[model samples]
Target chain A: MSDKGMNLTLKIWRQKDAQSQGKMETYQIADISEHMSFLEMLDVLNEQLISEGQEPVAFDHDCREGICGMCSLYINGEAHGPDRGVTTCQLHMRMFNDGDTIYIEPFRAKAFPVVKDLVVDRSAFDRIQHSGGFVSVNTSGNTQDANALPIPKDDADKAFDAATCIGCGACVATCKNASAMLYVSAKVSQFALLPQGKVEAKDRVMNMVKQMDLEGFGNCTNTGACEVECPKGISLDNIARMNREYLKAAIDK
Target chain B: MSVVSEDTFNSTSHFMGTNAVVQFVLQPILAFGVIFHLSMGIYLDTQNNKARSVKYAMNKPGTNSSWMSRNMKITGIMILLFLGLHFYDFWIPELNTKYIVGDMSGLNEHGGMRYFEELQHKFADPIWVILYVLSFVFLALHLLHGFQSAFQSVGFRHTKYTPIIQKLGNIYAIVVPLGFMFIAIFHYVSQL
Candidate 1:
């Protein structure tokens, strides 16, 4: 009590597997230092559970500094806890108060199903990327030199902004309709803005959008929730760009 | 103004009843537009619901998006309900008189042009006027998000123009509903 260690309650989703039902289970922890990251707090809870001969909570994390986009959670109804522009791993224990009850659950979408306690199968994102999220690179000794084509500074910066999206399902998880338009648009705009990407932009947008829809993601109603919950600060402008790109491609075809 | 001004109301009503373009072309087009918008809204909402079949245990939607954007379904359904009452009040009776009853005279029993009187009578009752005013409020709520959203849906965002479109959308949402509410209130108050 003299050390000022925080006492907290954690309510975590517990699911045996994808087919089994899940429920929120609560755990109480004491003496948690405020300096630890949110993941570290969960680590302490998991260690305690193991020592008590109980199964530990299962969650996903990698590159705890927040670049990999591997960690995804719906904390207390938010995509990555209460903080803005930070992933769950980047979230700190200082954000929570002593005796606070924290709720953690996996991101929910028809396209993202639970794999374990807080691990949902986000491979749907991968399939959408596979559809056309890349540029056709020439590697047969005929590749054009980099910067051969001049890109407008504004376009380059915007493309870089769109390029920062880590493919995390936060946008999808946060959207009411579970729309992936922001994510798909970011992928589309990254290339659409650049000369290299513009060559095949027509097919890229069309195929990627088709794949996105086939994965059972909802259509965008332009609520713009995805931008607010995005850890990378992705803009709603990307979704608008994607909509325009899709329309242009549809018309041209 | 039109409701209180009998001359303006009757001539407009008479022109509307007798004009082939208004009766055939405009009315059908308006009806189709309503049906398309209503059915599409319902279909999209149903699909949106299916996207997340499992409900969140403890989540807050208000932190991220506007209330109007989040609750389009509620506002849209309210507008639909009002449309039903509107059809019952005006359209059904108008159609009955013009078609089923075989009268296209657009005149009252005393032949003084019934359009103004009929419109006035609807507002004479506080309940009907209140219903109309309330419906206009819902219409404003629906358009607040919808006006700008349609442009986004169509991929029409320009750095210079998007802001203007958003501003225009807000103005349109406010002005259109306010105008309708004004008509309802003006009629009701003038009679009083």
Candidate 2:
């Protein structure tokens, strides 16, 4: 760790609300510690703004350790500030050099509207989740033992991989089409893969896809950028699986 | 020969080795594949549009996917429009002369109709030739993204195989359209 801090130029997006037009506001910061997390650097900037009697930039973040999926920003043309397999909070100032101009903006998608500076309404994801992201499980104590089900190793592994999706909307943010196929597919696969959830698999897939389409997202063109930007490293195979499931359900109906 | 329709495009070469098998079975399957692919492309484009009600105020698509991927629907629509004109120019006339008019004598000596002469006649007009060639250009652009994406959509993706598929797709996108364009230009220039 160097004792000297780095100075940087930041071009950040600032908007009072969703209805107002936004623009880039440039600011220069001095002596920023390289060891600081990207969010901490923002905090320093906010502190400076408050001290100067100005309103601080508004952004979304929670569980900075990267699991909660709340921290969302398009940093320097990337979902998480030029980092792979990490969220915005996981990004560090060390990734930038002194005097670098870092551009910060909210994730731009028709489905995801910018509420303020670097925060957008990600409730679209929640609506997709609410559509059909769960299995109808019995809460009764007489429920059958989960361990007794003999799921194949391959299926179990694939299901586990699909379940890791954090619904961060990096998939939507990074996709050229702004498609939520990756996020919706992961949620569908999480339920569709197991025998416990197989009972309502048909409705689960159809309803979720309908909701996704209704949410004003874009279609998956298989550009594969979503998987590249995903912090959890979600596979494109999940989308393929969901497509297959959707087709089967459609045919059955 | 009995099962093969003389009105169908040249099936004499038996590119699949067995003439009887290729003419009777393979040709129809190939036709079906072409029609299904075109129909599916249109259907998917409709779904793609419905997914987004409002357009983004600011979008930097080049940051992620290629321009071809971003504009596939436009390219696909261009190709589809071209196909309609193509079938009207060639297939409809052949069908009319062979089945409706019941005259094979004035048609191409190849059997039902003279495809070679028909092409020569159509390409004689420089405007038709130019439009024909432009359609192939659109076809190439569409194929640039479509060829590899078709494989991915069907779940045929792998690290080693994907690069090979993409390389082959690029070659097919360029070479196939270029080949068709060459044929049109060759006929047009020969007529002049």
Candidate 3:
């Protein structure tokens, strides 16, 4: 790809507040560096907006790296832009052509209401986390030995895979139903597959799933869009495992 | 309930596609998947409703997911209902004819025409034909989401092939249900 700068068109969503009606405002950026990250390009555009005495577009980002799960944007009909398995921060301008008209929109979901322009209030994720995303243990130093327990290799690997979920709303944003099954299942599987998490296993699946439902997210239709757009490449098997856990808990109850 | 209900036991008599490979190996796994999927669906539906205790004043789900994806539970419930009627119509009678009546003549005879005639008989009535067609519509909707979803659930996805899988899913969703609907309509028209 060329490192030369190029002019581009951007269609960004703008809203006054959460209650206000939102619309796509078009802006043109001239000579944006092709090597810049997608968010960096937006930063340059914001700088230009400030210089022009115009309100800058609002968006979300924490770590410039992909790990924090704070960077969320729906770019050109795909979550986190055209790049596969990367968040918005990782999306380089090289992915787009010189004169490309990129459409940037906030993650749309019932559970995720737009707080401003591209920043939606994602605390629905927090409530879900609170609903049993923890393990109970003695806070005192009398904890069990780390190597005391034995975990099967496959189970440990699967648990590690599930634990990589960053609780980003990308799964909900990408889902047609805006369902949080991927996120919830990841949380559930992380605990369900672990011996330490076995203490709250039943309640974990039941409560987390219940809270996820209560967040006004749409049901998972199993379209597989969430997995496709997930930055961490989390598997949908976690969801199946969650279903199994829920079923076992429900039967027991 | 019985470990294997009379319904399931009766249904097993007509496992026509379950050759040695399917019967001995795949059938059990498929059955577990179907049962688990249905049960999980019911629980998930309840949880989904609970999650969205307050409906959004305005929701534009079209922006994110497909229509089939959004309405899977509705279609799934409809399919479950259709399955009950299906088992009643064919599986139960097949069991009765084979075991209860001691007349195995119609059992797997006429190259499975008895089964064909059973379908024709059900579709002959306009009400049944409408119900059958409607069930296929729900079936199509369910399959539209379930087909590709099965692949994703099992952790199989590729940028190069995911689009192809989705396209194939759409084709299967349309063709299979449409084919079943046509069969029902054809039988109804033939009788008329």
Candidate 4:
């Protein structure tokens, strides 16, 4: 039952730039270990490429521990590879057959332009976060008592869940409209539930919506694809919350 | 005013002038005005139904009114009924005259139709006008909930942005329909 000496084929996308003509080049690897994480297999392949004086295929990975949110890859038509809820780094080679051909490609989005190969410039997400994502809390180490403001358990739980968004562009990549509503909503919800956020809530929604529109993100058709592909399973409820918040802001203004 | 020639000025003046009055104002108020509201209401209803099914499937069994889940279908249905009555009194007849009978009396010189005249004619009954105004009241209520809820459903209800969404909803609900109502009331009174 051990796959200590199995061969596999990798058909990876290769493009020089966003506008470059990209094609899938095939590579054959022999004697791969089933126990190797998907990324480790890539490391072994890279070693071989380097030994042959070939430029290793470029891909993004930082903190292979899966929390840094830097690893981005679409494997065989699934975001972050197969095995739901796990990022690409956590995927193991045991999931694949010995002679299977795995198709690997970069996450696609007009807003997320591809850099070299698997790497994409995800600064669009950063800009959206910068627009109106934070509360204007003074950083003077003014520690307020935690129990001074008692948020309902339900609200607190929802806030914590929304706050777990890691700013990965997977939602945007998976959405047919390329909508960032899920990401934006999570940011909005995180602040909205707390008393500290209520003071600037109105301006935040307005500014964020204006920024979202300005960023050329397609309108949300509510296909629910983003939720399905999201690594954290961020729900569509957050999108609903954002819509309500935006409407409230508009009326107040 | 100068004295008009007996041959030039005929008995048709009063009737022609009345027809002109009807064409300029009554037609569009009945036709497009009602159709616009009705179509919008129907569209909202469809969207609401979709949101309802989605929420129903997603919601846990014992959870209480979770804002967006509680309101989408109800608000959508209320808007649909509001627009239905609005159309029954105004749009149906106007459309009948404009399309089926090939009547252009309600239209203006710019080829744009005047709806106020038809509204006045219909609302002269008082019962129908009251019904029309009632529909608008419901429309206002529906918009009040819908505008804010749609954003929330889409995850726009952030701490910083939620208040803004609420404010915008209130304005849309109050201002747009109230403007239409003002015109409706003005025309109805002038006819009396």
lDDT of 4 by residue, B119-162 (tens): 44665677666665766776676677667755655455456677
Work out the iRMS of candidate 1.
0.9
lDDT of 3 at B12: 53
* Alpha-carbon runs more than 4 Å astray in model 3: B1-192
List the candidate 2 regions with Cα displacement exceeding 4 Å: A1-4, B1-60, B77-137, B151-175, B182-192
Candidate 4, A1-253: lDDT as tens digits? 6856679999887778777867778899999988898899889988999999987888899888767788888777766766667778888888888888888877776566778777877887788778889888777899686788888998889888998888776776655446678888889988888788888888887888777766656555454667777788887778887777887898889
TM-score of chain A of each: 0.97, 0.97, 0.98, 0.93
Deviating ranges (above 4 Å) for candidate 4: B1-192
Each candidate's DockQ: 0.81, 0.29, 0.15, 0.09
* Stretches of candidate 1 exceeding 4 Å from the true structure: A1-3
TM-score for all models, in order of appearance: 0.97, 0.78, 0.67, 0.60
Q: What is the lDDT of residue B70 in candidate 2?
A: 74
Clashing pairs in 2: A217-B51, B108-B113, B108-B114
What 10-residue stretch in candidate 1 chain A is worst by lDDT? A1-10
- Quote the positional error of residue A124 for candidate 3 in Å: 1.3
Local distance difference test scores for all models: 0.91, 0.81, 0.80, 0.70
By lDDT: ranked, best first: 1, 2, 3, 4
Best DockQ goes to which candidate? 1
lDDT of 2 by residue, A138-203 (tens): 888788889999999878888889999988898988776678999999999887889987999999
